[model samples]
Target: MPHSLPPAAPLRGRFDRFLILGAVCLAGFVLPLNFTGPPIATPAIAAELGGSPAALTWMTNAFMLAFGSCLMAAGALADGVGRKRVFGIGIAAFGVASSLLAFVPDLFWLNVLRVVQGVAAAAALSGGNAALAQEFHGAARLRAFSLLGTTFGIGLAFGPSLAGWLTQTHGWRSIFLSSVVVATAATVFGLPRMRESRDPAAAGIDVPGSLAFTAMLAAFTAGVLEAPARGWGHPLVLAALIGSGLLLALFVRIEQRSRRPMLDLALFRYPRFIGAQLLPIGTGFCYLVLIVLLPARLIGVEGYGALQAGLLMIALSLPMLVVPFVGAVASHRVPPGVLCSGGLLLAAAGLVWLGRADPGAGWIAPLLLIGIGAAVPWGLMDGLAISVVPKERAGMAAGIFGASRVSGEGVTIALASAALATFLGAGLQAALPGHAGRVAEIAQHLGIGDLAQARALLAPTLDPATLIGVYERAFGHLVDALAAATTVTAVLVLSLFGGASAHDIANTHEAPAARADGRPERVADCGAHG
Candidate 1:
């Protein structure tokens, strides 16, 4: 049986709904801030609390991996329990975790706390969004979600600059402290106004499926992040890589057998669904990786101050604020396939252009171009995610889509970061022939935007200018590779999204649901409901 809402009369009014939207938006805003802030603060964090290259990477990866892996489970938990209850718990836990992060003394504890924060975030996001959905209908829901997206964009747009200012003025720890305040406000204001709701038909949480998927993601990410430090052939690295594959196979088997699988393996049969899933993964490499890596490059290799680097990053993120709305409007006239695939192709070009631009004054154009291109799919992916699935399975589609996007970002950043470290180390080895053994250590520092520490590891006779040049070259190569990858993804998405009209797909390949006349029931397009 489908879940049903309570009587509309007592649920909420216009003002109350707006209040709920505001509260949810507040909580939602912090999530992007958490993601974008750490990379900017990374240099300062390293300067104050030392960590290994992999450990430093974990500061960000731990949060993302935990959040992504737990999101589907968190959604199910929210639906199984009460949305308000889970939302409040998540917000309170997030505040507490963030408070602890502010006082953490070492990298290990900080990473652990970040994972806690991530799980809290997953709960908060899943519960908050679902609760908000219950509060509005039709056009109101569309507008509410749009505002939520804008809030997230604002967070992404300003998080780096805000974090930079805070890091420069107070300390890296202030970033966590600030997030705590946002979480607190969200909990205080949102909880009372929100009524409790749950899915009566929701099965218990899929523990086995969740565990297998989480373990697979963790194993794979560990292999990727550790590989450059520990050679690919190292026992642990090999074990993690092999174990990741085994876990993935096991996850599929588990899901197939489960009465209520977290993911519907049958959904993968749809080419359009696969294409929709690719949108985030494509942007993950072309845009999300750059969001983390660019600030480090500006601060470490190009010798920009944290504040300067953050300000420069605005060019890349600002388009997210407005271009998405434009793309959403443009979708009325143009097919989404063109908009999505074309946007990625444009971003790929921007990546190539960025690779060639001078580090200082020449960056804004390419960054803005990339931002504008990536924003299109960013805006439309939610609708596309649901449009490709059966109407009854919209929630499942959304949960899986969210997981894919977040998990893809975590995995992509690990791979990109490792590749960057390898390239930088190789460059440094060639630049300083006698210091090959220490290049990995130096590259690790440089990779996190700790140029000062990286310099200390080098010979006093070696010019700082040579190291900067080598870093620039390595980064350039990485950008070129990202562009190539994005181009290939764009082509694949184009092929996948083409060849069939939505009507044809719905008529021919609709789920087993049938009409009274023995005809297959047509699946409605997401836009029709919106």
Candidate 2:
């Protein structure tokens, strides 16, 4: 059934607009909080649930995979149905899922509930954002989105400390319960006052494209996450990796054939657009992968409690709160190519510094440096994504960028985790040559900061200090690889951005009709900073 806009009078009222922004921001806040909090609690959850390494990884990956995969589809649904309605349903569903998660009996159910929460998160994020777009225009829209971004940053920055306190004080489950409260508040405050609006001409959901994309992401992430335990040569792991490629090919074909495709494939023809896509992938490897890995290492390997681990994480995440504004401002004076590539180069250096630093006390400076580097491009990428395409196709640009950012984060984190686990497993095998078969299981435990469990599983004679040393060495190797990957990405992005010429900049500003072919004539240049 189609929905139409409600009365303009109520929506125009200042109070209603405030309520709408507040509600949307609240939802935005919870999503990242939920995302970042779980990794901090992974050790606690493991201590009780006693899950396999793959299961532990799924606890986080399942939510991210579902969240990233469903985002575009959720946006389409919100547009077709009522944005307000979709937002309400999403927030309500998120609350229900979160409440259930607080009491989840095992890791299986925890991951199952997380998937539900992720779908809810997708609905809430897309619906709320779309609704906000309707509620505000021009300057107000920019300010509203800015606040929304800040709200998300605050949550991402502070989630670890808050969740750590909760985990230590109440239990790991309290973290979910807290989200339930926030979700309820969002629904109650925003839904009733918000005006209902829908795009009457919105395209129907692209089921084939959606399924293929989601499956591809899930299959690839699952294969990576499972590889540490199952081995890269395992038939299922090989099948999954191979199937992901096949799914990708099918997805491209489906998108090409669709009448109103979810993704606009034509955009990829532009080099600038391709470079814009690389921004998130670079940050994913350099920044997001660390967010998941660092907390576990601090608590389990470094002997910090959950609270201490969370406090330490603030060094890494705190810069996200302010450095993005620096990036935004620097875009004016510094060439965006310089700013972006420089930021990434800084991050690469920081990663190397971090890998060499002593385990616990020597981390803060490098963590802050990495965060600052990542934040520089983080703020610019969204605006850059929109500006790279024609104004008429801005929505498509946003959707594509959004999908790439989130999905790339999930895939990169999974790949890095798998590599780290494999490295750790190899170290364990070398040390305990007699029990080679159990190396993967021990690596799994050690990976999540369950050092006690890992110690128990291995030979009784191996000292705790020796095991910690092995884990640290493996982690350092992983960090070194991530740094190298980020550096390569930075070079490629710089080269791509360097290709832009003054003529291309002028072409991006020209009206579509100005071109002979009726398409945006050329890719954008650094003027994308605008």
Clashing pairs in 1: none
Measured by TM-score, how close is model 2 to the native structure? 0.89
TM-score per prediction, in order, is 0.91, 0.89
lDDT comparing candidate 2 with the true structure: 0.79
Estimate the lDDT of model 1.
Answer: 0.79
lDDT of 1 by residue, 211-306 (tens): 998999999999987877777899999999999999999999988787666676766766777887888889888888888888888887777887
lDDT of 2 by residue, 252-298 (tens): 99988876676767667666678888988998888888888888888
Candidates' lDDT values, in order? 0.79, 0.79
* Candidate 1 worst ten-residue window by lDDT: 521-530
What is the Cα-based TM-score of model 1?
0.91
